[model samples]
Target: MLVRIITGIIGITAAAFVIQTGGVVFAGFTLLLMLLAWFEYVRAFSERGMGIALVTGFIALAAMWYAAWQKPELLALACPLIVLVMLLESVLMRGSTSIMDALASGAGLIYIGFPFTCLLQLRGMLPETVFSTEISSFTFGCAFVWIMFIGTWASDTFAYFTGTAIGRHKLCPSISPNKTIEGFMGSVIGTTAVVAGLGYYLNLPLQEMAVLGLLIAIFATLGDLVESVAKRYVGIKDSGNIIPGHGGVWDRFDSVLFTAPLVFYFVQFVNLLGK
Candidate 1:
C-alpha cells in the first residue's frame, strides 16, 4: 500500500506538470504513452495468438497522434486513411492475414490512439469566442483537463476507501470482484463534490462541472472494469508492470481515456445550450 501510494503520487505529479506545460511537452508525453500503450496492447493480443500488423499499426498510430497534435480538425480525414492503410496491408499479406486481422489492428489504433488524442483536444479547448458567450471563466486552459483528472482520481480513491470500510453488494463480480455497489455510489458522490468545489474555485460552470463529475465517475468505473476484463481474458494481472506499483501506462490512464472524450463533448453540449 505504501509503495503504491508513493508511486501514484509521483505519477500524478509528473502528469500534472505535463498538463500545466501544455505544448510539445504534453504532446510528446502523450505520444510516448500512446506508443507504449499500443505496445502493451499488441503484446497482450499477440500472446493470445492474434496476428496484427506491427509496423503498419505503429505508423498509423504515429500519424493519428500527429493529426491530433498538429491538426485536430483533420482527424476525420486521418481516420479513414488509417482504415484504408490497414485494409491495404491486409491485402498485401493476403495469404497470411484476413480482414479480421486488419480490423483488430485498426481497433487498437482507435481504442488507444483516438482517446489519447483527446488529451490534446481537451487541453486545447475551443475558445469562448467560438461559442460567442463570455459569461463565465470558460477559457482554453487546463481547468477542464484538471477537473477530469482530479475527479476521476477522487472517485477511485473514495471507492477504494468506501469499499474497504463497508462494502456489501458486489458491483461486477465477474470482471472485478473487489468492487462494490456502496463503493461505486461513494465514488459518484465524492467525485461530484470534488469537482463542484473545483468549479467554484476556478469560476467555471458549476452545473456543468457537477454533471461532468457524475459522467467521470460512471465512465471511470466502466473504464477500470473494461481494462480488468481485458486483463482477465488475457490471464494477466497487470498490463506491463512499467510503473513501480501501478501496472502500466494503460492501467494508469484507462479512466482518463474513457473520461476525456466524454468531458470534451459534454462541455461542447453545455456551451451549445448556453448559446
Candidate 2:
C-alpha cells in the first residue's frame, strides 16, 4: 500500500507539471509516454510469441500523433494512412505473416495510437496554437485535461477501496474476477463528487461537470474492463513492470485512453450546443 500510494503521488505530480506547461513540453512528454506504452504493448504480445511489424506500427503511431497535434484537420487522412501502411507491411511479409498476426498488428496500432492521438488533440484545443498569446495562458485547456485525469484517478481509487472493503457481487468474473458491482457504483459517485467540487475552481458550470464526471466514470470502468480482457487474451497479469508499483504506462493510463477522447468530444458538443 505504501509503495502504491507513493507511486501515485509521483505520477500525479509529474502529470500536473506537464499539463501546466501545456505545449511542446506536454506534447513531448505524451509522445515519450506513447512510445513507452507502445513498447510495453508490443512486449506483451511478443510474450505470447505473436509477430507484428513493430517498426511500421511505431512510425504510424508517431505520425498520427504528430498530425493530431500539429494539424487536427489531418486526422481524417492520417488514420487511413496507418491502415494502409499496416496492410502494406502485411503483404510485404506475406510468406511469414499470418492473418491473425496482421490483424493483431492493426488492432495494436488502433488500440494504442488513436486514444493517445485524442490526448494530443485535447491538449491542442487552446484558443490558438501553443505559440499564440491570445489566451496568454492555457488555463481552460489545461484545466480540462487535469480534470479528466483527476476524475479518472478518483474513480479508480474509490473503486479500489470500496471493493476491497465490502465488495460482494462480481463485476466481470471472466475478465477481472476481483472487480465488484459495488466498486463500480462507488467509482461513479466518487468521480462525480470530485469533478463537481472542482468545477467552481475550474470556472466550469456545475451541471456540466456533473455530466462530464458521470461519463468519465462509466467510460473509465469500461476502459479498465477492456484492458483486462486484452491482458487476459495475452495471458499476462500486468502490462509491464516499468513502474515499481503502477505496472506500466498502459496500466496507469488505460482509463485515460477512453475518457480523454470522450470528454474532448463531449466538451465540443456542449460548446456547439451552447452557442
Candidate 3:
C-alpha cells in the first residue's frame, strides 16, 4: 500500500512537471500513453486469436492523436475511413465470420479512440484568455488536469477506505463485490468537498464549481464502475500489473477515460452557454 502511494505521488509529480513545460513534452507524454494503452488493448484481444486487431488499434490511436492535433475539422472525413478500415480488416481476419468479433473490434476503436481524442482536445481548448494573462497555458492546463485527477484519486481513496471500514451492504455484488452503497456515498462526499474547496480557492464561481464538482463526482463513479464491469466480463482482476501498487494502464486510466470526454464537453457547453 505504501509503495503504491509513493509511486503514485511520484508519477503524478512527474506528469505535472511535463505538462507544465507543455509543447513537445506534453505531446510526447500523451503520445506515449496512447501507444502503450493501444498496445495493451491489442494484446488482450489477440489472445482470442483476433489477427489485425493490433493494427486496427494502432491506426485508431494515431488517427485520434492526429485529429486532436492537426485536423479536427477532418474528423468528418476521417471517421468513415476508420470505419472502412476496420470493416475491411474484420473481413480479412480469419474466423471473423462471427459478428461478435467484428463488433468487438469496432467497439474497441470507439472506446479507446474517443477518450484519447478528448485528452488532446482538452489541451487544445485551454483558455487562451486565462493562460495568456499572468499564467502560462502549460501551467493552467496542468492545474486543470490536476484538479480533475484530485477528484478521481480522492474518490477512489475515500471509497476504498470507507468501504473497508463501514461496508455492510453491497452496492453491486455481481459487478464489484467489494463496493458498497456507503462507500459510494462516502466517495461522493469526499470528492465534492475537495473539488469545491479547490474551486473556491481558485476564485471560480461558486455555483459553477459546485456543478462541476457534482458532475465529476458522479461521472467519475460511473467511470470506475464501467471499468469494473469490463474487467468482470473479461475475467481479470487488474488490467495489468504495470505499477507496483496500481493496476495496469487501463486501471489507472479507467476513470479518466470517461472523465476526459465529460470534461471536454462540459467546458465546451459552458463556453457556448456563456457566449
Candidate 4:
C-alpha cells in the first residue's frame, strides 16, 4: 500500500512536470512511452510464437507515431494497410495458428496506440484564434490534459481504498475479481469532486465538467478491465514488474490509455459546440 502511494505520487509529479514543459519535451516523452508500450505489447504476443503479431504491432506504432506528429492524413492510409496485413497474415497462418493471436495484436494497437497518438494530436490541436501567444496556448492545452490525468488518478485511488474497506458486491468477477460496485461508485464520486474543483479553477462549464468526470470514470474502469482481461488470457499476473508497486508501464497507464482519447474528443466536441 505504501509502495503504491509513493509510486503514484512520484509518477503524477513527474508527468505533470513534463507536461507543463510542453513542446519537444512532452512530445518526446510521450513517443518514448508509446514505443516502450508497443515493445512490451509485442513481447507478450511473441511469447506465443506469433511472428506476424510483432510485425503488425510495430507497424501500428509507427503509423500512430507518424500520425500524431506529422500527418493526420496518413492515418486513413495506415488503417487499411493494417487491416490488409492482418487479414493476409491470418490466412497464411490458418493451418498453424489461432485467430486469437491476431486479435490480441490488433486490440493492443487500437487500445494503446490509438489513445497515445490522440493525446499527441490533442496537444497539437490548440486553436490559433484563441491566442497569439504560443506559451499561453500550450499552457491551456496542457491544463486540459492535466485535468484528465488528475481526475482519473483520483478516481482510481478512491476506488482502491473504498473497495478494500467496504466492498461487498463484485462488479465483474469473471473479468476482475477484486473490482466491486462500491469501488465503482467511489471512483465516480472522487472523479466528480476533482472534476468540479478543476473545472471551477479553469472556468470550464459546469455541465461539461460533470459529463467529463463521468466519462473519465467509465473509460478508466473499462481500461483497467481490458488490461485485466489481457493479463488473464496470457496467464500473467502483471504485464511486467518494472515499477516496484505498479506492476508495469501498462499497469500504470491502463486508465490513461482509454481515457485520453475520450477526453480529447470531448474537448474537441465542446470547442466545436462553442463555435
Instruction: Estimate every model's Cα lDDT from 0 to 1.
Output: 0.82, 0.82, 0.71, 0.77
Model 4 TM-score, 2 decimals:
0.87
Provide the clashing-pair count of each candidate structure.
0, 0, 0, 0
Per-residue alpha-carbon lDDT of candidate 4 for residues 103-124, written as tens digits (9 for 90 to 100): 6666667777788887887776
Report how far off residue 53 is in candidate 3 (Å). 0.7
Q: Work out the TM-score per prediction.
A: 0.90, 0.92, 0.87, 0.87
Give candidate 3's root-mean-square deviation (CA, Å). 2.9
C-alpha positional error of residue 84 in candidate 1 after TM-score superposition, expressed in Å: 3.5
Model 2: lDDT to the true structure: 0.82
lDDT of 3 by residue, 87-187 (tens): 77656764653455666666777676777677766665554535332444333445556667777788788888989999899988888889899888888
lDDT of 1 by residue, 134-200 (tens): 4344345466777778888998999999998999999999999999999999999999989888767
- The better-scoring model by TM-score among 2 and 4 is 2
Clashes in model 4: which pairs? none
> Once superposed on the true structure, which residue ranges of model 1 sit more than 4 Å away at CA?
126-139, 272-275
lDDT of 2 by residue, 1-275 (tens): 89988987887788878888878999998888888888888888887788877777778888888888888789889887777767776678888776667788877788778888887778767544222234334455666787788899898988999999989999999989999999999999999989988775545678888888899999999999989988998899899888878899899888888998887888777852233
